[model samples]
Target: MESYFRYDRMMPREYQRRIAENVIAKGNSLVILPTGLGKTAIALLVADKYLREGKRVLFLAPTKPLCEQHRKSFEELMKLEKGDVVLITGELNAEKRRGMWEAGRVIVATPQCVKNDLKKERMRLNFGLVVLDEVHRAVGNYAYTFVAEECRRSGLHLLGLTASPGSSKEKIEKMSELLGVKNIEIREETDEDVRKYVQPIEIRWETVEFPSEMDEIRKLLEQMIEERMEVLRKFEWIKAKNFRSLSKRVLMQVRERIERSSGGVKWMGLSQHAALMNLLHAHELLETQGASTFAEFFGRMEAKEKKSKAVMRILKDGRVKLALEKASQLKVDHPKLEKLRQIIETGKGKMYIVFVQYRDQVKKVVEELNKIPGVRAERFVGKREGVTQEEQKRTIERFRNGEFNVLVASSIGEEGLDIPAVDCVIFYEPIPSEIRNIQRRGRTARTRPGEVIILITKNTRDEAYYWVARSRERKMKRVVRGMQKMLQDRRKGAQSKLTEFV
Candidate 1:
């Protein structure tokens, strides 16, 4: 086993070696190396060299744990006092962050926190170098782009670090342009330099098919579509209202036919309504892109708001109020929870990291797991209404320490968090976004052997998304390896010329 070396403990490994050599050759870089490939080690190695020259450095990770992890690595490498390296997070007070910024040589923080400091004019960026961790997020609305833009505007050099820059060539190039990167350094596990240090990733895909009882429920859903349409109309869905309003006094018969067809289907539980809403949200993502997608989702949310208003409006209408009361009691069965429980009980020995897209779904998983005797489970989420940072840290630490066998988490748990290695990763639902899928699976298959199980509800959007993510992941791996090969080849060509001249 390779020694668990701190930043300054031993000579740099393959990933770090490439980074060190490149930083010495080219002033700024964008390094794309996969997870667990020692990206932080490279950052630390470069920071150590730059700090020795009395240069200040800024390292931006995507989350708090990552910031703390990088800060700890820097402190150990520089052998500095506690005050010399500090982490700036949302949890810290602005005054404390300002003080830390002024005094610290190495400032580690999430991109948003750094952006806020810059926005408030509380922090200065005279640093010689800025390192962007998980640099793939340099896309629209992500704080990484904001921080990188600010660095460029302030005239500071940058080093972008990411496992997969992006799933597509266009996205990868776009991120590169956004970060102002001229040289892209990529490395693959198959490369001579990487092979020595890169652990082999054995990915196994386990597919879950729905039982016949679930299939019957899905068919019944289609049959009752008309009833649901009427329910939505009562809720003042403009789409339903417009269909009713426009067809009135003209083509009344056609409108009636359409309404009769739609109203024929039956709808299920509040839980199912929530599930359907989520499925609709995913469909919106797949069928739309850019600003159009945002507009569509916003439109649906507005419609839902209107529906709720309609419900409140008719509370005084005796007939409508009674109907509304009865509809609210319509319970949709969430059988998946019990299925998940069974999986957990039977797969006890296999370490699992469970992913649910929504926070409420994560809570549901935690609640269900809690009901199972001898099963320990907790949710890992960002600081929100019901969870605290301390709780998140404790949950992570417990899972890492083997005190807990499973971690139920939301999308917040996906990126940049140092979740320990596990044997199995189970997605509560398939995430359509390629970036999210990569980050989720990255928690497992980190080192040693691992498997990913996707629990897809039959006849739902989950089915399509599972394949969509798989295709994207395969494409991304190829792209990462291709970029790495190009860099290595260029390095060899340059070395060959020098040898010939000698």
Candidate 2:
């Protein structure tokens, strides 16, 4: 750990001091620091202090890549042997996981696998501390709750690390309750104490209008919502008590229609299982949206249901079936795709990273980029068939070395992967989650000036998400600043009281 400080000339001393103070506080704490603000360093400091006290620590992340990133950060900061730290993602064998968990003093793992391991009763029973990274995912049914429960039952210290824990007040309280977090340490990117540690982030917003063809389709689709509602009502797919319950069904239908249309009958027939698997994905998206929302997060859920009902009603009338068919056939570009193309072209000699929300969209980006000459692109997504972790690492290394000028990545690259800094990041569409937004942006501006260009489709769910994220990011920054100020004030008050008593 002392040797690592030789490289610490790059980090701000204030950050180290804050982390030291936090570790000594000796209670559960929620830290709010923006991306690229050294949250991993704080975790490392805490891990070292706790481990020195004969306590093992578990660092939890929402994703495997982030777990790996935290493990690397710990190794770099603590100068520990590889055997001293372990990254437990789903990729590991059960036997290997059991072995690593027992041997490692500092273990980093995805919450899901950790929770499953606990369920399987694989316990060394010596872990005295737990660190929850991206702690915002602590919401309903997420494995974070189970991990927290296990830690509490074990009487270990709890620490939560996140940029935005709660988009709303209820969410914040829920996170607190989940982790037994009694104290919170927040650092603002704009705070005087933290400004020296933050790099400048320039965000450029561009809104693209929907293709003209989709406009009439969108209107006609809206008109048919009543009929769709009636069909669902007839089928009992949704309870009459809540209209929003039917939202999932509508999204599923839309997703199916899109896939079938895109793949055609031949592809769909040959890959029926894959087609149905897409339905599973659509279901997950809807479930995540409906997890805690009584209403739709952005009206996409509600609006889709309403549109489906109206579309069904018109179908019964037989007047708009032909129109609907044409609407479905109308090819609509994401609008920002062209802008992304321009960014890639304009930012010559710089690496461009693009983030899209869907797997299908990721494929579309790769296909589009392939059409361009001398522009090789690769997809960095969750570990799937044909892509091993080692291969993924090699691919990223190649991209960093300029073997590929552009990288088309999914949410996987947004988290803790060791992807090199890019000159420009293009968002295929604005996302609803603030955590994703921050992580996506964090991939850039690590060593030099970087730009983030968000491609938003105007007047659609994309625009709505854009504004929602912006508002939430602003609120989060404010909350972080307030918390930092409170900490400073408390420190000042303590010092003043001590002087007066003396």
Candidate 3:
């Protein structure tokens, strides 16, 4: 095997080297390696090819901490001097960054900042390569898309990296297209090259009851959701067989569809759509999440300033009122909480990361976990929730230092935050998104054998969502592999035509 980098110690494994060579050969590749399988190492090897050519490189991560992480990894592994790698942040003046752009061999920054710099003409695409850390987000109007367009415009080689690039085929294809990815590389844990490096992850589930009273509330909310849907269906606005089968993704379109409608039907459908969303949310909270979360949802809606007619209609519903009273009358929290506490108490792991979907549940989980003796847990959330980046970094550092044995985080923890040495991952509730499921599972079993325990409430979306995500994960791997094959065939076809012409 040809050695790609002479930066001193630390060489890539056979699989990493092969992938890196493939990426270098393919030009503008999207790498879908599982988390912790050394995607950065592959990038480092590829970057060496560019750096040796005396060209600059740009690494784009979604967040500042991630940017710092990639920069540190390149510096340490490549044995680069401190001045060689630049960490660009908004804190620095544009002129300072402009100077660093030319001065540094490698630059790392958030996509938003990079896009602004590119727009201001302060940064040039003179680099040999650009690496987008979470490239699955390269769709739509995200900053990643803008930077990717610039790379294509400059005819610069670019690499997009992500562990789980979503399960939707259209979304994946769009991401590949927008990023100008000519080749898609996906490696499964079952692959012979990858299986040896990945440890076994045992997955199991603990079931909790959907308390009878809570079931009553869920039924009430479901009735409301179905009623709205039924009316919309009569109006030919929705065509779902049942509300239970309808997804939030589908329901979200109703608002836009309503807006495009004319006359009295527009406001009518809009009101119904809004009510359906609110009812569905309340039902999900009561069924899948805890009562306190449900109450919080209701409270937030009530607290909204200048409520819309739809909101007022939902607030005035007798069923909604009765359900709220019933939830308040109940003394116990979501059964999943007690189940989670029990699992943490008896779990064999030294450190646990609990993934919850709701911010209310994140705080609730932390409060519940800390109640256990000898358990130190902290809530990890996003800036929108009032937690600053400094606080987030400090919380992660504290967790890493073992000051906290458990980190109860929302969706923010699902991605590439690098919470190390996690022995187990617990899902506070099952989510239907396959990307999140894979990301959450990747939290554990990176370096050591670990287990994942899912808390499921029987006869609810919790169980249904678990199945949906698992099925979609399997389908996602197939989708990405299909994309890879498609690209390969197209390349081959192009080559054959060129040979014929010759």
The TM-scores of all predictions, comma-separated, are 0.72, 0.74, 0.95
Candidate 2, TM-score vs. the true structure? 0.74
Model 1 lDDT on a 0 to 1 scale = 0.66
Q: Is candidate 1 or candidate 2 better by TM-score?
A: 2
Model 2 has a clash total of 12
lDDT, candidate 1, 356-433, per-residue tens: 776546766787787878788877777675677667878888888988788888777877777888887888777657
Clashing pairs in 3: none
In model 2, which runs have C-alpha deviations exceeding 4 angstroms?
A: 1-12, 87-100, 226-334, 383-388, 477-502
* lDDT on C-alpha atoms for all candidate structures: 0.66, 0.66, 0.86
Per-residue lDDT tens digits for candidate 3, residues 152-263, read 8889998999998888999998888877888887889999988999999999999999877677777788788888988998888888977778787787776667788999
lDDT of 2 by residue, 250-369 (tens): 555644544544335434332332322333333233222111111122224335544443233323544244444554464555456666777676666778898877665677678778
Q: List the lowest-lDDT window of 10 residues for candidate 3.
A: 1-10
Error of 1 at 56 (Å): 0.7
Model 1 alpha-carbon drift over 4 Å, by segment: 1-11, 92-96, 189-192, 196-202, 205-339, 371-373, 477-502
